[model samples]
Target: MQINCTVIIQAFNFLITYLFLRKFFFHPTVQLIKQKDTAKKILAEKLKLKELAVSNLVAKKNSDLDAFRYSISQRYQKPEQAVIQIEPNVLSKQEVIVSPEVIEECKNSILKGVHNAL
Candidate 1:
């Protein structure tokens, strides 16, 4: 088979066109895809970092709340202890100071309640 000059020229033109299109179009498109992938990766990493920061803040707030609760419990415990200590002493030292008239009134009220119940 004899080689034709037109065929050789056509093959060369096709190769040039392929290389030109790859350089101008395909390479830039691939680069743009790579850039988008890189941007997505960076954004994902930033989101993870922010999530970690928020979790740490929540943990800190919970710990602070626990400490506050502990302090309030301690403060209330002192008042409760003082009241317990004072209660027995106050009860032991105090005497019932009912007068004769008040005792008679209490008896009369009790008799009235019994009569109403019957």
Candidate 2:
């Protein structure tokens, strides 16, 4: 088979064009795409770490709140228990009986105050 000059020239032109496009355009675009992918992976890892930190913080706060509530309940309960223990003793004290003469004197004083107000 005889080779044509036009076919060789066209093939050479295609090879040169392909090499130039790959060097200037295709390679840079591929590199940019790879960089973006790496950045996305790094961001995802950072997000997972942040979520884990938030969960740990929430757990610590919950435990602290529970401890504070327990301490407050104990503080209130001690006074309530003391008051309950002292209430019976206070109620068991004897009643005093007033003399008839003293009762009559108080009634007379009250009546005098009412008359003066009128």
Cα lDDT listed for each candidate: 0.84, 0.83
lDDT per residue for candidate 1 within 1-118, as digits (tens), equals: 9999999999999999999999999999999999999999999999999999999999999999999999999877742222112223533555868899978986996676656554
lDDT of 2 by residue, 1-118 (tens): 9999999999999999999999999999999999999999999999999999999999999999999999999877642222112224633458746789978986886676656554
RMSD of 2: 11.5
Clashing pairs in 1: none
Q: What are the clashing pairs of model 2?
A: none
Q: What is the lDDT of candidate 2?
A: 0.83
**TM-score, model 2 to reference:** 0.64
Cα shift from native, residue 13, model 1 (Å):
1.9
Error of 1 at 44 (Å): 1.4
lDDT, candidate 1, equals 0.84
